[model samples]
Target: MTTCRLCGSSNLASVVDLGATPPCERFLTSEQLDEEEPSFPLHLRVCTSCWLAQIPPLITPEETFTEYAYFSSYSRSWVDHAKSFVDAAVDRLALGRDSFVVEVASNDGYLLKHVVQQGIRCLGIEPSRNVGEAARAEGVPTSTTFLSESSGSEVRDGHGPADLVVANNVYAHIPDIVGFTKGLRALVADDGWVSIEVQHLLTLINNVQYDTIYHEHFQYYTVESARNALDSGGLSLVDVELLDTHGGSIRLWARPREVTGEQSARMVDVLEKEKAAGLHELSGYADFSANVTRVRLDLLRFLVAMEEAGKSVVGYGAPGKGNTLLNHCGIRTDLLPYTVDRNPYKHGRFTPGTRIPVLPPERIAADRPDYVLVLPWNLKAEIMTQLSYVAEWGGKLVFPIPRLEIVEVNS
Candidate 1:
């Protein structure tokens, strides 16, 4: 029986089943193109007792994220978001040259660039070799390995404890979440803070973002669920902020018990709202499966209809979220011939499982397909603005989540 990763509860219900899919970021090279991509069941379940949304245990960290193809610097909007985060963190913590900042899963030194500019001693822990190497090339001191109890102990011995420990959009990627949190306690100073930014589960469920359900994201965390995970490792959440990034996210500030601070009023308000909204109830998750099925059917119908009309359809953003949607909906090259991505590493490769070739964004401008399906719906606005030329050809952009709808360029 599969048990809850946090509370060890075996009581769970299958909320949405995404079938089998390959890891979204694992684009295949030309040499590896002949090999069949590995796929595993993409099932999401909610613990009836703990309200924790999680995927089944299948892939390990070593199998999923070592030679990662994604880089944070590729997205202009994501870079802007990271810069804003660094600015706020510096201001809130009153950090200076004496302060030390440690970032977990710090891909490509995007955020650390801002921290280092302030002359603060900053170190990054990135597990992916490709991304870590890129960060090193940019003068960001990065360690390429997973952060667990042993690694955290070594870090404490060498650099003492950190003044600020930041993790951006990475808390959900861990499998042994309990061990990860315990490691955070080891690396944090008594009066220091550990800030974590995660995609909020409530927002995802409300927005019908079934595409985010992938194996890479092992857990979907709510504030209540997060508090339990933190308390399990002797950490306490002191503040929380609702962020606009990642569609909707939460930035949580935590500290050891020795440091006392009032819980943010906004945090309390959101927690109470969640409690009232039945987040702690099992029935709240029951309807998600139906929504997932509806999304798949609608997207497939739209694609088949476009094909019948002789309108070529292409995809934008070869992100993990997009991969989940594609593979779950059984989308192959028959429906989407190719996808455009700005990430150089992913260029000239095929998306895992579906095998859709990924080319540079210039393909969108050159081919000007009749329909451009914005896969990463979270960045629909950013992508729409970038590919506005599609409108000149009487083409419309299709957003395939929540619902499949094509909107005019100015609409």
Candidate 2:
């Protein structure tokens, strides 16, 4: 029986099932691709007790993220987002040289660099050795270890409690979430703040972002669930921001429950919004499976029609989200041919389950495929701007989520 990760309730219900898929970010080499690949069932189970949407136990953290391929610095928009967050955090906290900052899952030092530039002491806690090495090379002091109570206490004891603890897009990657949160309390100062950014469950359902459901992502959070997780871990949410990054996300600020500060009005407002959207009710999630099936059929039809018309289709971005979409839809190289990404780590690697060869962005111009499927649909605007040349050849850019639609490129 699959019990809820948040509340330990066996009253878990499966809302969206993508069948079985390999680790979404496990891009394969030529040799690995030739060998048989392993896959696990991908299903989002909602906890009736707490409303946290989570994937049933499939793979461990070491299997999903230890030798991670995804890096934060590669995306210009993501770096900018991090910089903006750093700016806001510095200003909001009135942080200066005396303040210490730490970021968990700090891939490639993208955000901490901005913090360090402000003359504040910054440290990164990242599990991936390769990514930690890159962060350290860039002058960001990073520790390559999984965040737990012991590691968090070690960090606190070694460098003192952090004035600001940041965890962005990482809360979902953890398997033992309670331990992860308890570790946050250990790392944070009494008066310091804890900020987390998670892809909101409300946004995921309303946007039909089923592609975000993968092995690497364990739990999706609504405001209530987010609050529950924080409270359980000995923290309290004080403020919140609904952001548009990663399709849609929620940036939450938390502090130790003992802190006497009143909750921010915006946080209350967001909670009310979630309540109005029926996030606490099972009825809110009942239709997601149907929507997932609809998109799958719609995407299949689009791919089939394009292929029938002798159209050559290529993909942009070898993101884990793309892998989920591809593998779940049973799309293979025969349909996609090859995909392009700017990240060199994934350039020569094949996508996990489908085995689609990833090439450089230059391949789009060389091959001039009839259609370019924008796999990372959330970054469509940025990608479309970069691949504007595709329009010159009468090729249309395709966005696969929320419905597959051809986008207009500037002349």
Evaluated with lDDT, which candidate comes out highest? 2
Instruction: List the pairs of residues colliding in candidate 1.
Output: none
Whole-model Cα lDDT of every candidate shown, in order: 0.86, 0.90
Model 1 ranges off by over 4 Å: none
In model 2, residue pairs whose N, Cα or C atoms come closer than 3 Å (at least 3 residues apart or on different chains), thus clashing, are none
For model 1, residues 104-185, the per-residue Cα lDDT tens digits are 9998999998888778998999999988999999999999889997898798888889999998888999989889998888
Question: Where does the lowest 10-residue lDDT sum fall in candidate 1?
Answer: 277-286
lDDT string for model 2 (68-186, tens) is 89888988889999999999888989999999999999999999999878889989999999999999999999999999988999999999999999999999999788999999999
RMSD of each: 1.5, 1.0
- Write down the lDDT that model 2 would get: 0.90
